[model samples]
Target chain A: MSTVRVENIKKTYEKGQVLALDDVSFEVKSGELFGLIGPDGAGKTSLFRILTTLLVPDAGRAEVAGLDVVKDLWKIRQIVGYMPGKFSLYQDLSIEENLNFFATVFNTTVAKNYHLIEEIYVQIEPFKHRLAGKLSGGMKQKLALCCALIHEPKVLFLDEPTTGVDPVSRKEFWDMLDRLKARGITIVVSTPYMDEASRCDRIALIQKGKILELDTLEQIIARHAQNLYAVDADNRYNLMNDLRKNTEIVSAFAFGEEQHVTLPPHFQDEYLSAFLKEKGHTGIKVRKIAPTIEDTFIKLMLENQ
Target chain B: MRNLVFLLQKEFRQIFRNPTILRMILIMPIMQLIVIPLAADYEIKHISISVVDQDHSTYSSKLVNKMTASGYFQLVEYTQSYAQATKTVGDGKTDLILTIPAHFERDLIKFNKAQLHLAADAVNGVRAGLGTAYAAQMIGDFNREIREEWMLLPKFNEMPQIEITSANWYNPHFDYHLFMVPGILAILVTMVGAFLTALNIVAEKEVGTIEQINVTPLKKHEFILGKLIPFWVLGMVSITLGMIVTFVIFRFLPVGSFFTIYAFSAVYMFGVLGIGLLISTFADTQQQATLFAFFCMMVFILLGGLYTPIESMPEWAQWLTRINPPAYFIKIIRAVYIKGSAFSDLIPEFLVMIAFAVGFNALAVFNYRKRSA
Candidate 1:
C-alpha cells in the first residue's frame, strides 16, 4: 500500500507570479525510505508542507496514510510527523521540555515512546535541560527528530534534516532513519545534497519545480549514464576549456581538480591524448569513470532546460 | 482536554521565561497607576492674573484683594494701565488680564450696575476658561456683599433673594485621582492583555515554532485557548496590582464590592484578548503584530471616555466609542468604583461586555486557520 500519494500538485506565490510546484506527482510505498533530491528552491519544502497538511495546494490532491491531505487533515495530522525545513522547536524551551510537550500534544508520554527515540535521545540526553537555542546545529536536529518521532507516527516527513549538520552527525541521523525504517515506519525526506540521494531506497531528482527523474540510485545511473571520463592535467582550467571546445565531447563539467566529460561510446583515450598534445597540452591523464548521482542529476537538469 | 493543558503549560512556561513579560506584568501597573493619574489631573489652580485697577478706589483695591484671597488666582501684576497688563500677558508672564474702569465704585452706587472689562489669554482653553469664571465669580460675590452691607438685608429694595446650594456627590471633594485611578486601571489591564496576547502567536511565527504546532493533532480552539488563558490570568494580575497601588498611594478603594470589579474585568479581558488574538491572525511577524495592536489600542484609548466624557464628545466620536471595547470597560469600572453600582444596575453594560467577549473571540477563532491559504 502507498503511504503517501500526490497527484498533479500545483502551487504559486505572489498571486501566481512565482511557480513553486508545478504538476508534481509521486508516491511512497509503505515502509520505504523515499527521498526528494534537489538543490535549494527546487520546491522541496512546498511538497513537504502539502503532505504535512500545513499548506493547501493550489490544484490537485495529496493523501497521507490513505487520507486526503485537504479534507482529512486532522486525521492525517494525527498519523504523520513533520519536521519543517526551518529549526522550529521553541528556542526558550529546554530539549526535554520540547520533547515532552510534543508527546503530550499527541496524547502520549515521553516514557511510553522512549524506545522510538532512545538511540538518538541518548546522544543528546545529557544536555536535555539546556535551552534548544543553545544547542549546536547537530544536537538541535537530533532533538527535533526525537520530538517528531515521540508519537510513533506511521509516516515521518523530514525536510532537509541534515542540511547544516556536520558530516559525522549527518551519517548518524541517516543511520537512525534506517533503524526507524526497520520498524516499519515509512519515511519521506528531502535534501539539497546529492550525496544523500544514494541513502534513500528511491529518490526523485527534481529541479525548477519539476521532477527530472525518479528511480532507485543504480537504475537512475544505469539508464541515464553516458560514456563519461575524468581527465586531469597540470593546468586544470586550460584543460577544461580545451575539452569543452572538442566536438567529440558531449558534455564537460569541472568536478573538483578533474574535468568530467561524456564522449561518444568506445572513444579511445589515445585519440584525446593526441589531440591535446597538438594543442600544446602536457601531463594529461584520462580514465573511464562511473557516473555519480550528481553527474546524472546535472545531465538531466541540463536536458530539462 | 489533555492537549489544552499541555499547551497552557508550555505557554505559561514561555511567559515566565521571558524577562520582558515579567517586567511588563509587574512594573507596568505600578508605573502607570502612580504616574498617569498624578499627571493627568485636570483641576486648574494658581492661575497667574495681572489686574489693571484704573478706579483707584477702596472698592477696586478691595476687589483685587478679594481676587487674591480666593486662593485660585496669583496677583502677578497690579499695574494701573491696561496696556502694561496686556503686555505682561503677551509676554506669557500672566494668564489673565483684568481692567477695572474709572469710577467703577461710583457707577455701582449711582446706576446699580458696573462694568469691568476682563480679557483672558485664551491659548490654554481650560485654564483660561476656568480662570475667567473664577475671577467673574469673585467679582459677583463682592457685588452681593456690598449690597448687603449698604442696604442692611434688602428690606428697602423689596427684592426676594434666592439662595442656591449645590452638593458634589460620589466624590465630595471632587478628588481628581478618585476619578482617574479606575480609568487608568482599566487602561493598564487592557494594554497588558492586548499587547502580550498580540505578540504571542506572531513571535512563534517569526521563530518558526508555529509551523510545528500547526502540524500536530491539537485543535485550533485548543491552540487559541492556550494562547488566551495565560494572558487573561496576567491581565487579572495587572488589575490586582493596580488596585493595590491605588489604595497605597491614594488611600482609595472601589466603593462597590471587589466582586463586581473582578467579575466585570474577567469578561472585559476576554474581549481585549480577543482583539489581540484577532490581530495576530492578520500579521505574519512580531513587528507587524506590534504595530497593528498599537494602532488599534491608540484608537481604543483615545475615544474610551477616560479623559473626556462620552456625552461631551462629538457625535461621530461618540458613535465610534460605542464600538470600542475599552470604552465599555472604562464606563463599567467607573460606575463600580465611584457610583457603587451593583450588578443589577449595570446589567446593560454587563450584556454589552458579554457580547463583545463572544463577538471578538468568535471572529478570532473563525479567522484562525489551522491550514495555510
Candidate 2:
C-alpha cells in the first residue's frame, strides 16, 4: 500500500521567483524506510513540508494515507508524526513536561504511547526533570522524537533529523528508525549525508529542487554504467591533470584517499598503467573499485550537466 | 477545551518554576501598589518660604508671623534685601517670598487697609496657583482677626445669598490608594498578558522549537490557541491576586460584584494576549518581542486612564482612549467598585472590550504562519 503519494508538486518562494521544489513527485510505500537524499537548498525541507501538510503546493496533489493533503489537513496531522530538521522542543519545560504537553495536545497520555518511545526515552529518562534547554544535543533530538511519536503517528516525516548530531548518535537514531519501520510505520526522512542513503530501503537523489534518480539503494548503485578505477601516484595533482588531458578518460575526480577515474569501455588497464609510467609518473598505482553512492550521485549530476 | 486546559497548566508550571520571571511579574505590581500612590499626590503642604522685611514695622512683622503660623508655609529664611530673597527663590531654596513694605501700624489704622507684596515662584503652575490662594486666605484671616479684636464694624455693599456646597462622590475622602490600586492591578495584568506571551512565543521561534511543533499534527489554530489560553488565564489569576492584596492590605474593595470585575478582566486579557501573540508573529527574537510588547504596553497604559482621568482628557485623546481596552476596563472596575454600578451600566465598555478581544485574536491567528511545506 502506498502511504504517501505526491504528484506534480511545485513550491516557489518570493511569489514564484525562487523555485524551492520543482515539479516534485514521488511515493512512499507502506512500512518502507524511504530517504530523500540531497544537499542543503535542494528542496528536501520544502518537499517534506508539503507532504506533512504544513505547506500548500502551488500545483499538484499529495495524499497521506489516501487523504488529500490540502482537503484533509486535520486528519493528516493526526496520522503523521513530523520531527523537523531543527530541535524545537520547549526549552523552559522539563523533559517530562515537554513530553506530557505534546501528548496532551494530541489528546493522548504519555503512558498510552510510552511503549512507542520507550527505547529512545530511556536514554534521557535519567535527566527527565532537567529543562529541555539544558540537555545535550543528542538528548534534545531524542526528546523531540518522543514528542513527535506521542500520538503514534503512522507516517513519520523526519527532515534532516541527524544533521548536527555526533556520529554515534546519528547511527543510534537511524537504528531507532529501523525499529520503528519494523512496526509498520512508513518513514520519509531527508538528509544531506550520503552515507545514510545506504541505510534506507529506497532513496531519491535530489539536487537543485529536482530528483536526479529514485530507486532502491542497490538498484541506484547498480545503475552506474562506467568502468571506474582509483588511481594514486607520487604527484596526485599531476596525476589528475595527466588523466584529465587524456581524451580516452571519460571522467577523473578525486575521492578520499585516491582519485576515481572513469574510462571508455575499450580502454585497457595494462596500456593505461604503461602510459602513466612513460609520462614520468613513478610508483603509480591503479586498481578497479566499486562506485559509492556519492560517486554515483556525482556521476549522475555530471552526466545531467 | 481539553488542550487549552493542558496548555494553561503547563504555562502556570513554567511561570511558577522560573523564580526570576515570577519575581519580576509579582514584585513589580506589589511595589507599584504600595509605593506609587504615596509618590503621586496633588495636594500641597509644608511649602518653604523666605520673608524680606524691608520696613521691620509692627504690621510687617505681624504679617510674617501670620504666614509662618499657618501650617501651609514654613518660614525658612529672613532676608534683608530683595535681591537675596529673589536669589533664594530662583535657587529653589524657597518656594515663595513675602516682601513687606516699610509701613508702620499707623498706615493700617489710618488707611483702613495695607498692601502686602507676595512673590511666588510659578515654575510649577499648579503649585504656584495653590500657593497664591493660600497666601490670600492667610492675609485675609489676619485682617479679620485685627478687626474683631478692635470691635470695628465695616459696612459691606452687597453679599450674595447663593450658596455652593460641593460633595465629592465615590471616594469622598479622596484616598489615592482607592483609585490607584485598581489601576496598578490593570497595568500588572496587561504586562503579564502582553509581554509574557509575546516573549514566550518569540523565545520558541528563536530557539527553533517552533519548528518542532510546526512539523507535528498540531494545527496552526490549535497551536496558537494552546499558547494564548494559558497566558490569558495567568493574567486573570494575577489580577485576582492583586485585587485580593488590595482588599487585605490597602482595605480597598470594589462595591460591585467580583464576578463582574473578573468577567471584564478576562475579556480584556484575551485582547492583551492576542496583541502579544500578534507581536510574537512579527518578531524573530525574544528581545524584539520584549521591546515591541513594552512599547505597546506603554501606549495602552498611558491611554488607559491609569494616571489621568479619561473625562478630563482632550477630545482627540478621549477618542483614542475609546479603543484602549485598559481604559475601558479601568473605568468599569472603578465604577463597579466605587459606584456599585451594575453590568447593564457597563454594556458599552464591555462591548468594546469584546470587540478588541475578537479583533486582536483574529489578527494574531491570521498573522501566524505555518512552515512552507
Candidate 3:
C-alpha cells in the first residue's frame, strides 16, 4: 500500500505568476525509501511542504496515511514528521530541551521513543546541555533529526536534510536513514546531490518544476539509448570545443575532468580516435563509459528540450 | 491543552535560563517601583527668595519671619537694592522677590493697610502657582495678626469678615509617590509581557525555528497560546511583586478588592501579549519586533494616563484612551487602590479590557502565516 500519495500537485506563488510545482505526481510505498532528486527551485521543497500539510497546494490532492492532506491535516501532523531545508531547531534551547519540547508537542516523551532516535542522539548527547545555537553544523543537523523523530513518526519527510553538512556527516545521516528504513518506516527525502540518489529504492528526477523521469537507478541508466564516450587530451577545453563543433557528436558536455560525448549510432570509437589523431590531435584518450544518474538527468533534460 | 502546558514550560525555561531576560523581567520592575516614584514627584518645595526690605522696620521683619516659617520659601539673599533682587530672580538663583514698600510706622497707623509687592517666576506654571498661594496665605495671616494687635482700641469687630475652607478628597496628603507607583507597575508589566514576547517570537522567525514548529504536530492555536500564556503569567507575577513592594516599602495598598485588580490586570495583559504577537507576525527580525513593540508601548502608556489624569485630557485624547488597554487597566488599578472602588463600579473598564484582549488575539492569529509564501 502507498503510505504517501500526491496527484497533479501544482503550487504557485505571487498569485500564480511563479509556478513552484507544476503537475507533479508521485508516490511512496509503505516501507520504501523514495528520493526526489533535483536542483534548487525544482519544486522539491514545495512538494514536501504540501505533503507535510504546512502549505495548501494551488491545485491537486495529497494524502498521508490514507487521509486527505487538507481535510485531515491534524491527523496527518500526528503521524508524519518533517524537517525543513534549513537548520530550524530552537537555537536558544538546549539540545535536550528541544528534544523534550518536540516530544511533548506530540503528546509523547523522549523515553517512549528514545530508541528511534538513539543512534543519532547519542553523538550529541554529551553536549545536550549546550545551547543549540552554539553547536556545530553537524550537531545541529543531528539534533534537528532527533526532534523530527522524537515521536516515532510513521512517515518522515525531509527536505534537503543534508544541505550544508560536511560530507562525512552526510554519509552518516544517510546510514541512519537506512537503519530507520529497516524498521518499516516510509522515508521521502529530497536532495540536490546526485550521488545520494543511488541509495534510494527509486528516484524521481525533477527540473524546472517538472518531473522528467521516475525509476530505479539502474532502470534510469538502462534507458540511456545512446553510444557515449569519454574524451580527454592535454588541453581539456580545446578537446571539448572540438567535440561540440563536430557534427558527428550528437551531444557533448563536461563531466568531472573528462568530457562525456554522445555519438551517432553508427559511429565507432576506433574510427573516431583515428580521425582525431589524423586531425593533428595528440595524446588523445577515448573510452566507453557508463551513464550515471546525473548523466541520465542531463540527457532527459536535453531530450525534453 | 497538553501542548499548551509544554509550550508554557518551554517559555518558562527560556525566560529563566536566559540571565539577561530574567534580570530584565525582575530587576527592571523593582527599579521602576522604587526609583521612578522618588524621581517623578510634581510637588514643589524649598522655593528660594530674595527680600528687598525698603521699610527696614519690625513690621517688615515680622512679615519675613512668617513667610520663612511656612517652610515653603527660604531667605536665600537679603538685597538692599531692588535691582539686585530682580537680578537674583532673573538668574534663577531665587524663585521670587519680596519687595517691601518704604513706609513709616505712621502709615500703618493712619492707613490700617500696607501693600507688599511679590514678583514670582512663572515659567513652571504648577510650581509658581503653589509658591504664590503659599506667600499670599502667609502675608494674609501676618496682616490679621497686626490688625488684632491694633484692636486694643476695641473697634476691629466693625471690619468685614472673610472665611476660607478647603477640603481635599481621595488623597488628602497629595503624596505623588502613591499615585505614581501603581501606574509604573502597569507600565513595567506591559514591557515585560508584550515587548518581550513579541521579540521572542520574531527572533525565532529570524533564526528559522518557527518553520520547525510549523512542520511539527503543533496546531496554530496551540502554538500562539503557548507562547502568550506564559508571558501573561509572568506579567502578573511582576505586577504582584510590584504591589508587594509598594505596600512594604511605600506603605501603600489598594483599598478595593485584590481579585478585581488581578482580573483586570490579567485581561489587560492578554491584550498586550496579543499586540506583541501581532508585531511578531509582521516583523521579520527581533530588532524590528523590539522597535515596533517599543513604539506601540510608548503610545499605549502615554495615553494610559500614567503622567496626566485621563479626565484632564482633551475629549479626542480621552476617546482614544478607550481603545488603549493600559488606560483601562491603570484606571481600574488606581480606582481600586486609591478610591477603594468595588468590582461593580469597574464593570465597564473590565468589559473594555476583555474586548481588547479578544480583538487583538484574533487579529494576531489571523495575521500569522502558516506558509512561507
The superposed Cα distance between candidate 1 and the true structure at residue B306, in angstroms, equals: 1.0
> Model 3 misses residue B229 by how many Å?
3.1
Candidate 3 chain B: 10-residue stretch with minimal lDDT: B104-113
Model 2 alpha-carbon drift over 4 Å, by segment: A92-131, A221-288, A299-305, B1-16, B44-167, B201-229, B255-260, B280-284, B342-347, B362-373
**Position A203, candidate 1: lDDT:** 97
Local accuracy of candidate 1 as per-residue lDDT tens digits, B1-373: 7788889999999989999999989998899888998898787889999989889999999999999988899999988999899899899999998999999999988998989988999999889999999888888898888988877854687556889998989999888988888998999989998889989888987899889998999888898889999999999999999999999999988899899999999999998898888888889988898888888878887899889888999999989999998898898898999999988899999999999999998998889886882
Candidate 2 DockQ category?
Answer: acceptable
Best of the candidates, DockQ? 1
Model 1 agreement with the true structure over A158-263: per-residue lDDT tens digits: 9999999999999989999999999999999999999999899999998888988899999999999688888888888889889989998888999988888888
**Selected candidate, larger TM-score, 2 vs 3:** 2
Deviation from truth (RMSD, Å), model 1:
3.3
Clash pairs for candidate 1: none
After superposing the true interface residues, what Cα RMSD does each candidate give? 1.3, 2.7, 2.0
lDDT of each: 0.91, 0.85, 0.86
Score candidate 3 by DockQ.
0.49
Superposed model 1: Cα runs more than 4 Å off:
A227-254, A257-289, B49-69, B74-94, B97-123, B139-163
Writing each residue's lDDT as its tens digit, candidate 3 over B179-294 gives 88878888888888788888888877887788778767777888888788888888988899888889888999898988888888888899889888888888998888877877
TM-score of candidate 2 versus the correct structure, residues matched by position: 0.80
